[model samples]
Target: MAKKNVLIIGAGGVAQVVAHKVAQSAAEFGALHIANRTQSKADAIIQTLRDKGHRMPFASHALDAMDPAAVEALIRQLDAGIVINVGTAFINMTVLEGCIRAGAAYIDTAIHEDPARICETPPWYGNYEWKRRDDVAKAGITAILGAGFDPGVVNAYARLAEDEYFDKIDSIDIVDINAGSHGRWFATNFDPEINFREFTGTVYSWQGGEWRENRMFEVGREWDLPVVGKQKAYLSGHDEVHSLSARYPDADVRFWMGFGDHYINVFTVLQKLGLLSEQPVRTAEGLEVVPLKVVKAVLPDPASLAPDYTGKTCIGDLVKGSLDGKPGEVFIYNVADHKQAFEEVGSQGISYTAGVPPVAAAILVARGTWDVKKMANVEDLPARPFLELLGRMGLPTRVIDATGDHPI
Candidate 1:
């Protein structure tokens, strides 16, 4: 059978990585098309592909992803079988609607976050994406949410633990530690506004059939990881915990992120001056401005960090449970290198880690191994294939079992 055509949305750093990987695995996909709000950015990533001598047939277009009608029209035009959305979090619903209307599978890295709100309440998926679940089911389209690293692979870790190692999972601690550095004084590795907004809101976690909320940095601890040992990570609100809470209501779910002293200090100082607020306020000249927006305007774009990025990132799920009626716990994780990712995909380790998985999902959708005809999350699919794909794609998974750490 001929492979299905794919349309990749967005032209950011993650989108660049996705395009390269999709090109590398073009045999698994038919035509690979890309679209973005800015035509030049889309063309630029395609240019990289041409430089690499990619054999895949490629095309680029200008798109306003906020418009469902236009997006659906483009999908019909391309006859796309899968839409890989690595765009800004703001345009998720429109693109998903487009995919549903076009009768194509959909995949994305993170949950949709409204530009107006810093953070919504607990169960963030229900706020916007989940309401479309019934419509997706009615249309019989596969909509996979949060297919990125934390929300993406971490979800897979939880499923792997539940399926292979545990009889009854007691607790899950999702940890993301990036020991890599960009050699910059002060900057966020992702969108500055989005990064700051994530922490400024309530940190919600589900434990023992109850929800707990705390302020950012209010709870923190030190963890000794595989390569980057003894780093301090704080319990923070994250995208995966929201959906995991719904899936495993009985299991405790929480997320922690590693941060250095410099980042914390800078973030604290910016926040104290009200520069991180999403709300717009008047300046001395009476011009309306959102402080956080201004900060993002002045900060370095995350894509620029790749050239100077060095070190590694260790991310995984630590699951504690009963195995054959005996209490046990294990850490299932992947470690990525910045230099290796830059040489392979022209992106930093973080973006490489997040970008590669959704492309794997897209290829599986093309191959029919994961073309389930309904809305699903990464955890709802088999983990072995996904882990194997990552292993070949530069991010390999290793399990710390009772015997020792080794590849699965």
Candidate 2:
């Protein structure tokens, strides 16, 4: 069989990390191709690789990721056996379809979203990605959904708990704390539009074998986590909670994200003023624009924050259950430094953390370790190899319990 190539479908910070990591592991792939709506962004990333002295064959292409035919055409033209989709959440379904049509293994870092919907319902995957499960199976293509940090590594953490630590899992609390500083007055860690859209809707959590809902910032808790120390996190609707609830229906699944006072205040004001609305409205001059898009345009690009970004991020799963009929709780997490990430990948810790895992997934697909010809989430696959590969690539996993914090 010919060596499979990887086609990365984005050119943002996360995509930059993916490109670099893929280049570093060049021997695992045939050729690398990156495509985006703007070709220049792809060129810049490839140039960075060139400056870094990476000798991998890389090319850039222009693509409207929302157009499935265009994405499929690029995949076929590149002879890509795998598509690592680090694009915005809105493009997930289109990219998956393209991958299916092109017979390329699919890996995405986030759940698919409808441009017009906000927090459609619990089990978000079922709302979009899961609907295409039959199509994926029939085509015999592997589609690994939500392959980023929280949805990716955290999902693996849950599976690890089931595989080793617990016999009957009870609750899974996924906490994401970005104690990192981007040195900005107010800017999102990723795309401003996606960041704002996540919080502008109802907060959903799975508990007591049922779906629960609340307002964003309505439930806040202070966690004294390792390295980063104590920080305030809010229960927020996220991609993982939906699929996790379905997989571990008996367990309580919730996602908490750290937020400082400044962010809460700014987000509150924006929501109240309707400045975060995704719907388009006409101005006095009859020029139509989405308020959310306007806000995104004014904020600093997330990728730009890599240079001066500092501090660390601690994201992990707090799993509570019974082990050998004894009550137990274990926190499986990884701490990443922004400066270290930028020095290594030319991106901030947030992007680095989110970006690395999909490449690992791609490697597994190439190696046939995770090339299950069907649709699945991170938790549905074997966790150890993926976690081990992540450790070698950049993000290593550590478990905290009565045994102490040690690498797994």
Candidate 3:
């Protein structure tokens, strides 16, 4: 296969990690390009590459990814064969369309979310991405959805269980625990608006072959995880569940995320006060503003917290099923340290974990390992090669089974 030039959209925390990792693996690709609404941010990332002595041919561009025509034009201009979108979730569809038009492989971390709507119907991909399945297929370009850690790695974990460990799968419980602290009074790991938008809506999980709904934080369980130890994780709606359920309809699929009491208290107060509302309201000064955007503007940017960040994150899939006619369980996980991530990539663990996998996916695409030339969730592809590549790319995988815990 010919070397594919890479174009990365968005210059946020996750995008930073993606740029760094792509630079580290620059030999596999023809050239590297980074684009964002703020060209300066993208340029800063390129400067960081220079500071780290990565001499791969790289340039930055200003892009408004919401405009499909502009996105297409940029992709064509850069001749980007693989477009890594680490932008806000709202731009997924537009970026995917651009890739389709430009015939570039697409990859993103999260599902596409509407700016006006909080939570749409279940199987979120159907609302936006999956609708373009025929387009991607006809275009003959790969589009890998939800390639980040939770949705990305966790999806692969489920596939790994089905492939190697399970005869009849029963359940897939994805737990995400961030024991890291950015030393802030309160701030989200990623975008504050996207972070708040996630929980403010109904929490949906797949159980008993049906979609189950519950309020956020209404269901909580203590998980004795490997590195993070005992952490309380609440049942949460996530991207992987939607795709994973379609693949393993007979098995229960759920996502749980750890949150401290302080976070709960503050989120509750914000929700009750309507500060998390996405809808615009006219202020007393006759200025219409979205409450959620205002709160996000007031909060510290998620990227700035990396400098003071400390601790680690444990995120994985705990799969339960019958293997060899006997019930068995396995937990496939990865632990990332914030300080270590900062030392290497100038980002925190959350950004590092979310950022690294997509580059791995890009490498797989460049090497023809995951270039299926169609739309797919991470689980829809082969699991071993992706997981093994991730292991070699800094975010190593670990397994805990009846035999005891060890590296994958």
Return the TM-score for each candidate structure: 0.98, 0.99, 0.99
**How do the residues 156-222 of candidate 2 rate in per-residue lDDT, one tens digit apiece?**
9999999999999999999999998888899999999899989999999999999898999999999
Worst 10 residues of 3 by lDDT: 118-127
* lDDT of candidate 3 over 127-212, digit per residue (tens): 99999999999999999999999889999999999999998999999999999899999999999999999999999999999999
lDDT of 1 at 134: 86
Q: State how far residue 364 of model 1 sits from its true place (Å).
A: 1.3
Q: What is the number of backbone collisions in each predicted candidate, taken in the order shown?
A: 0, 0, 0
Q: Which ranges of candidate 1 are over 4 A from the true structure? A: none
Per residue, candidate 1 scores C-alpha lDDT tens digits across 1-408 of 767899999998899999999999988889999999998999999998998889789999999999999999999999898899998899999999998898989999999989987678778898988899988888888888999898999999899988899989888999999999999998887878778889998899999798899999999999998988888999999999999888889999999999999999999999999999888899899999989999999999999999999999999999999988999999999999999999888889999998999998887777777888888888888988888888887778999989899997
What value does the lDDT take at residue 17 in candidate 3?
97
